[model samples]
Target: MEAFFYIVPSLMIAALLSGVWRLMRRSRRVARAWGGGRTAQARCLRSYTTTSGGGDTMVSTTLHHVYEFTTREGRAVRFEEANGPGTTLEGDLVTVHYAAGHPEEATATAPAPGRLLAESGCLLLFLGVAIAFCVLFMVTAHEMFAETDGLMP
Candidate 1:
């Protein structure tokens, strides 16, 4: 049981770390190559439209502003989830970086390595780590409890 606890946490942490590392590295390289350019940072001005006196009030509509990155090859690319009413606006000029090899590979300015790996935000990377920690804690507690009670349940 103890061995299982150690192995499970180690694997979970390894996977999470690998994913976070990859994203951080990719984002960093992009920033280093194209930190300053013709990037536009626009504020996300949103408007909700709905029908009056309608039972479908729960349904909502919004106009999202997206950022477009024009690579040197005349190709346009945008960051993932970096669009919509919740993200930066259309007219806002945001610092962006792109992959020289694949123009389509672009994103908002690369975050600091430390920030990318261990920062508090709504990013998927952070979420992955958080979930991994939760699982690890649960597994460890269960193993400890099972060992003490000598019961499988």
Candidate 2:
């Protein structure tokens, strides 16, 4: 149906916007954490996996790691983060950056300048291509429908 076509494009736009919003929030979080936080060596306390969506389709599993570190004032803090497999294992030592007041909010890796630029460029290109295709498809469909008299039952 023509209504269905328009709805699909609207959904795609909404989804794209949602993705961009999430990316921006994460970028802000990472930037703030890395820029003003103190760095420390953290020990990998444990690792675990969580699964979702099984049966008759693909099963998705995500690896999460917990790390513990002590502050200069001698307080111990532990936090968990989801990361790819083999990135961190039990007993591994990794460098982390965390705010002085909130040691629980820490990041394991800092984004490299080149890598950040490339990632942003890739996201921009993807958005442009996806929007172009959606516009082209909608235009073509509208024109085709305009040339027709009406829907044949």
Candidate 3:
């Protein structure tokens, strides 16, 4: 059981690192293929839904919000500006930045504070907890092995 715990963590970390590496490589490759143009913005529409269990009433909302622009070629990209709410409505026009080389490679011209913060926080928290657990497992396993081997006796 101790050995299993020790090995599982190492395997998990290895898998995670490999997956991240692959994603980064793929993102870079797509960015390069898009000619890297950075000036473009487009509006995206999203629909929100609300559900109620009382009676037979279900409500779905189709609100149009302007999402950050993304290029067709590379990985999706969105941008938000520092001023005002970065998100825009369906009919709202936004400026996008693109790579000059790839005029089609563009993102919205603003920063998405809420999305960025939430995503970053979740990622950090998950990684931190995962690593801590893995380290703890390793330490426990080492102690178990030492005791079983009569090293401390």
**Best by TM-score, which number?**
2
- Model 1: CA > 4 A from native: 33-65, 81-87, 90-95, 110-153
Whose lDDT is greatest here? 2
Candidate 2 differs from the real structure by a C-alpha RMSD in angstroms, to one decimal, of 3.2
- Give Cα distance to truth, residue 29, candidate 2, Å: 2.1
- Candidate 2 lDDT by residue in tens digits, 44-123: 99999999888888998888988899887898989887854476789999888877776777777664656665776788
Whole-model lDDT for model 2 versus the true structure?
0.77
After TM-score superposition, the amount by which residue 14's alpha carbon in candidate 1 deviates from its true location, in angstroms, is: 2.2
Candidate 3 positional error at 78, Å: 15
Writing each residue's lDDT as its tens digit, candidate 3 over 1-153 gives: 656766888998777666556555534534443434445556554423333355567654333233455555655554332223334545566666556555433444344446545655566567667777878888877887788883432
Per-residue alpha-carbon lDDT of candidate 1 for residues 1-153, written as tens digits (9 for 90 to 100): 645666677677777777767666755655544644434332223323333344855654544334565666666565443323344544666665554664455555444545643443335657586766858696767777778784445
Cα lDDT for residue 126, candidate 3: 72
Give each model's whole-structure lDDT.
0.54, 0.77, 0.54
How high is each candidate's TM-score?
0.39, 0.74, 0.43
Ordering by TM-score: 2, 3, 1
Worst 10 residues of 2 by lDDT: 144-153
Q: What ranges in model 2 sit over 4 Å off?
A: 51-61, 70-77, 84-87, 99-104, 149-153
